[model samples]
Target: MEENRKYPRVRTGYQVRLTHRQYGYWVGSVANMSEGGIFVAELRPSEFTLGLEIDAAILGEGWDKGLPALRMKVIRIEEKGIALAFVEPDYPLWDSGKLSESTQSPNQ
Candidate 1:
């Protein structure tokens, strides 16, 4: 398969909380991540649908203490999980802990 992704992905096992206006909340772990998107694993198929808009928050150790919820759009659905792309490319809050060395700002 051809690798045409704009951002390189890092394999990770960070917990994630997914929220939708209609669906409430669903929890899963991040299988991998890139600047553009994330792949969440172990999510129930019935919890999400393709093209759904959602808000996500990364949880657990090493994550930012005040990690802002991210707005994402479902781009792909796999047998085990779903892929979500960030609506905005710039996510300073998402770059905390193991992901990057930048410090979180209060105004973000």
Candidate 2:
């Protein structure tokens, strides 16, 4: 089969937490990521529907400092997980020590 993705995806094992308008919040791990989207592994298919909009924040490592939440739309569903497309073309990834500097209290 020919791959038709605009952005190349890389395999990743990052943890993430997602929030949906109807579903509240849930946790999942990212199986792969691309500039355009991400495949969330281990997410229950029954908990999501195609076209559902959600906000997600990458968890682990630098998350204790701060990570920006991304707005995405559920595009594909499979037996293991769901695919989410980022609402914006450009979304930033968190790096260790980077967030702590920006998220620090002024009083400290």
Candidate 3:
């Protein structure tokens, strides 16, 4: 395994999408997230590969705003679903339209 920067990431509860293995699609929630990667939960480990493509969206409330088509890659697989290391994770909270993207897990 490669060395990680060990950046402190914030735990967020957001809706995400991953390609289904058998057919159709599967959904996941953001357990935690950093600029480099995200830990998603409630996913089928069997449906992921070392370099699987994952499409995730930061589901929102009130206004129903989220990120654009996000593209990520699976880098590790823990006890649960594969860990997705975003090849390009862009949570542009700067965009006035995306200002709400940083809302931590509702409980956080």
Candidate 4:
């Protein structure tokens, strides 16, 4: 089937720390990403509703510790994890030098 997504997802392995009122904080690996949102793997924590916003911080070797957390809303959920859309989509976050060469997929 043809993909109908406005943004094509690129597979990624970046880690993220998520914070929520009910769930507190937890770490999960980013399964993929696009300019619009990110798919965090192994993030299933209790029951999460659609449109529920959460605080997220990308954590990895090259990522800066000073970067502030992002406000992301749950858009979709699968058995493995949840897909979160940026509450305020900032295109620069995707193209920023901070993402850097180290975090890109092998094919990129």
Candidate 5:
């Protein structure tokens, strides 16, 4: 098959938390990442559906507790995992002020 991805992906081991309004929450590890999207592995396929909007938060060692979750849309599903594309690709992930008011923690 031809590789038609717009952005190149890099392998990663970052832990990620994904939350859905209907499916609850899932914790998985990132398989790879690209500017346009991310692939997360080890999550149950039955919990996701293509085109579903979800929130993703990278759980790094120094991950900011105040940072808002990134909005992503499910684009693909496979045995390995599910692929998600950023809903707002150009959104400033590091700018807490811009997103703080619009998002809240899943725990809340």
Candidate 6:
């Protein structure tokens, strides 16, 4: 919420998947997300430093909505995970129906 307004963030609590060539595989939760990057919460701090390419999956409704499994470059690192920028998104993320649409409605 706060991150996206300032930096194109993705939905928090969304389960995300991370993978690397050498590290093999790992799973994490999205602490924060944005068009530019996402913060993951892994079991342990990631060895992935800046400039590493990784495949990320944004889990959606059942499994089909799962974000296009895009790649990202580690731009920042945290104690529990890493922040990454989108290598590529399935389509224009903002307009695509794959992700849920805002339901703020017209009353507010």
| TM-scores for all predictions | 0.77, 0.74, 0.64, 0.74, 0.74, 0.63
Pairs in clash, predicted candidate 4: none
lDDT, candidate 3, residue 29?
79
RMSD of each: 7.4, 7.9, 8.4, 7.5, 9.1, 7.0
lDDT of 4 by residue, 43-105 (tens): 664567798889999988877899999899999988889889989755455646678778889
Best candidate (score: lDDT): 5
- Candidate 5, position 8, lDDT: 96
Q: Which stretches of candidate 6 lie over 4 Å from their true place?
A: 1-11, 88-108
Itemize residue pairs with steric clashes in candidate 3.
none
- Per-residue lDDT over 55-96 for candidate 6, one digit per residue giving the tens place of the 0 to 100 score: 887775655663467888888777877777877656665844
Report how far off residue 11 is in candidate 5 (Å).
1.0
lDDT of 3 by residue, 1-108 (tens): 976667777877676776534556778877888888888888877767788776656664532564465678888887676678767536653655554746745674
Give the distance in Å from residue 73's predicted Cα in candidate 1 to where it truly belongs.
0.7
lDDT of 1 by residue, 4-45 (tens): 889999998798999988879999999999999899998886
Worst 10 residues of 2 by lDDT: 88-97
- Over 4 Å off, model 4: 89-108
Total clashes for model 2? 0
- Go through the candidates in order and give the clash count of each: 0, 0, 0, 0, 0, 7
User: Ten-residue segment with the worst summed lDDT in candidate 6?
Assistant: 95-104
- The global Cα lDDT (0 to 1) of model 4 is 0.86
| Local accuracy by lDDT, each model | 0.86, 0.85, 0.71, 0.86, 0.88, 0.73
Query: Which 10 consecutive positions of candidate 1 have the poorest summed lDDT?
Result: 93-102
